[model samples]
Target: MKKKRILSLCMGLFFSTLLYSQMVGIKTNVVMDALRIINVGAEIGLSKKMTLDLYANYNPWEYKELQMMKMLALQPELRYWFCDRFNGHFVGAHIHGGVYQAAGIDMPFGIWPDLKDHRFKGHFYGMGVSYGYQWILSKRWNLEGNIGFGYARVKYEQFECKTCGDKVGEGHKNYVGPTKAALSLIYVF
Candidate 1:
């Protein structure tokens, strides 16, 4: 019931934005694609220098019996273009939320040292600021690069391994680091 309401609200907002937007862009993050995570985004021009972007990604494949990465995430950002919407440099403020299940993966910088040996199922929410640049590739295509940093509040239950049912621990963690990265291919209409 709660999930449905959230989904409905997002859909409503997306449609309403589309109705008033002068330009709309559809995009896919190549970085996510390379990792076998499917992702898509839509940017709606709200003004000459402003736009709203909605992005979502999903990963559901298991690499092996003991290794897996399954997740779904959604992010929405409001951007201020230094030059014009969908062109040149921009800065944005964004909020993100997601649920994940991961195991048998080494986290960079030793942030989650136990992840390589344990499984974690969790949910997280965060907000951040980002800087990005977009280049016009053709009359209807563009390329974009963006990065963001911020904090996330994560809550998770730990299991001994990917297939283990015994819960070993559960806790909340506050993390601060890179929150968003994207190299996207976009088409404008």
Candidate 2:
């Protein structure tokens, strides 16, 4: 959150010093997370060639008590206008990463072993980059199409239990995998 604020401030200062074309908008996507996510977010253009964005998502996973995961992501990117109408565009490879957590589940470990008195928790951190294109419909309304790839590392730890058997025993399981691809839209304000 603080990082986003600082990036916004820096962009504001940089753009304020020059007369550059800029706009803001909001975006929504239904196929963000394996078709289990609906995302609504906002974006800002610092110039005709640069953009800064911050957004959040509600992801639904049906395996635990916290069935929905919420995330906050901040991205600062550079773009090149391929045309004058904001129609054809190219966005450079950008770095976007943030914090998020999964909900509902009491155990992070795989299918509970044969333990009857043990439980666990699974938490994670992720970072990645994406490449894509943007098509501006107007000053404030634009449709963006991009493919984003990233990685997420999950921390799984065991809890207290006596009958935990070999299934729910104590210990840690760390999972690192590709975060997934993002096909989303954006509304610049």
Candidate 3:
């Protein structure tokens, strides 16, 4: 099946990268965790100053009958370290894709004015650029912070409330603003 093929390809890529990488880091974004979203990421050193990073996050719980923040997201980035891999400053280019179901939430910056009164289920895809800093905490741990800004093309179906299945509107939106933010704990090897 298609799912099996995708899983197999991902496993092969992961293992093959492990074989040749100079270093690998496993990380979790604490910001996402604080919001009850589960997230994990890996950074594979491709060269002395370059690395590939992959990150994924998911949330599936509803807080109340009409309050929810449920979604799955993935982002992959290529980074160039200013000093050395996992050391100091870095810049990256990344692509992101995700699906979300949200209701009764007040989004920051008034990005989605109707979210607090309506429910939305949608998928989005986009790209962005980021700047980040990583601080070595010890022999095998690090702290990292990053922020990115760019564009997302969102397509969604709107409903009156979280449990209301009656679709009211559906359309495409072009969004521009902050795309990523992370405060992460990383274990390096």
Candidate 4:
């Protein structure tokens, strides 16, 4: 009877810990200058070693001749932390989808030269696996770096210019390369 009670107490503690560890965070990738990129997310601890995060990125800016980046994207990921939740090394599988419009914008990593010297107004979606490391900066702050590889199916139409909005060509592309890349400054709570 005492052993049963102990086991029950332990299980109850585990469940309560998971419940209390639920966190909400907001982050931004400061590298992309043109689009004011911000991602908001909620993290739910599934186990001591696993978490589920859902986040979305929105850029509500219009494309001028110089402002070259704009997109709206949603990303949901299931991550397995090697040591613990919200800390250390993590491996994740993420699926992301979004719509974008830009001209002469260069995507970083291996996904570069995307629409070089040209403009495209279209939509893209993809899925990928990522490896990331999160560093605890303070009690409520974390900095994370992540890199991912996958494929994006992009359907786009070429424009003669961004501001003028004159259509020059139209087609779709299946891009198989780096899909997710971010150096994130995170505010964890």
Candidate 5:
């Protein structure tokens, strides 16, 4: 129910922004790709100093062996740039929602314990503010580096088996930490 509402709302915003913006662009998050997750996004110029970015990422490979992550995330952000439409320093506010499954991984900062004999699956959503820098490579090429931090609320259910997924328990976590980190390669049109 909640996921449906959020997805509908974001889809609506994506379409509306597509219809209104004069300049639009496509981007790939290299950080995600390097980690075996697929990521793509669109950027719409909103004003002389502002832009809207909508991005989605997914990890489709096996989580247990290599990546240790299985998830899908949708993030939309409004950015205020300091110089021009897509260059220089910028600040952004973003909201994101996603589904995740984790198991047998000892996450950094005590974010996750070694679920050596179990797994967790559930949803999470949060908002954050970020600072970034964009460099112009050519007339239509750009490179961006961004890091965001704020809060996250995760709700998940434990499973007896990482593969079979037999439910055992449920839990929630509140975190104050990094929510987004992106190194994007963008193409403008």
Candidate 6:
């Protein structure tokens, strides 16, 4: 019910914005010192100074011994361009809503009776804000970069087995710290 409504609303917004002539772009980035993050993002310009962006990311790490931790996220954002050109540069702000998954945690309240190989899954809601600059490389291409901070709250779920089985109950809650760093990219129309 609620998930359907959310998906429908996102689809509606995505299609409704396609009526304009805008620049489209894709970006990729890797995060350092952490669990090795891989990020991909897409953007559609609403105007010269405003646009919408959708993004996703993944992080892979090891939990304790018998488990692995993988985190995935999807984010949609509204960006406001602050400067059109400065030394052949562009600047903007990105406000984002993020959804995420965290895997391989302990089952809450020992939901599983045996507790042999039960796996845990977590869902999160998050937000991010970033300021960035793009340097023009050609007529329709540019090099872009940004630094940002983000936070997330997660609720976990319990599964009896690694692959298939029964789910016990709602999981646990986690508060994630902010992310601060840079993402560089090549933009195109």
lDDT of each: 0.92, 0.49, 0.90, 0.73, 0.85, 0.58
Per-structure clash totals for the candidates: 0, 15, 0, 0, 0, 2
lDDT, candidate 4, 54-149, per-residue tens: 666767665555656677677778899999888989999988777787766656764636465667877877888989998999998988888888
- Estimate the overall C-alpha local distance difference test score of candidate 5: 0.85
Compared with the true structure, what per-residue lDDT tens digits does model 5 show for residues 15-115?
Answer: 78888898888899998988889888999998899999999988766764633468889888999999988889999999988998866676766667646
Q: Which runs in model 5 stand beyond 4 Å of their true positions?
A: 1-12, 64-68, 114-116
| Best-fitting candidate, scored by lDDT | 1
User: lDDT tens string, model 6, 43-86?
Assistant: 77767777676666666655565555566556666767776431
| Ranked candidates (lDDT, high to low) | 1, 3, 5, 4, 6, 2
Q: Lowest summed lDDT over 10 consecutive residues: which window, candidate 4? A: 30-39
Better of 3 and 6 by TM-score: 3
TM-score winner between 5 and 6, please give it: 5
Query: Which residue runs does candidate 3 get wrong by more than 4 Å?
Result: 1-12
Clashing pairs in 1: none
Each prediction's Cα RMSD? 1.4, 7.2, 1.9, 11.3, 2.4, 6.7
Residue by residue across 1-189, what tens digits does model 1's lDDT show? 876787788888888888888999999999999998989899999899999999999898989657888888899999999999999999999999988999988788999888899999989999999999999999999999999998899999999776776899999899998999999999999
Candidate 2 local distance difference test against the native: 0.49
Compose the digit string of candidate 3's lDDT tens values, residues 11-50: 6777788788899999999999898898888899999999
TM-score of each: 0.94, 0.52, 0.92, 0.73, 0.89, 0.58
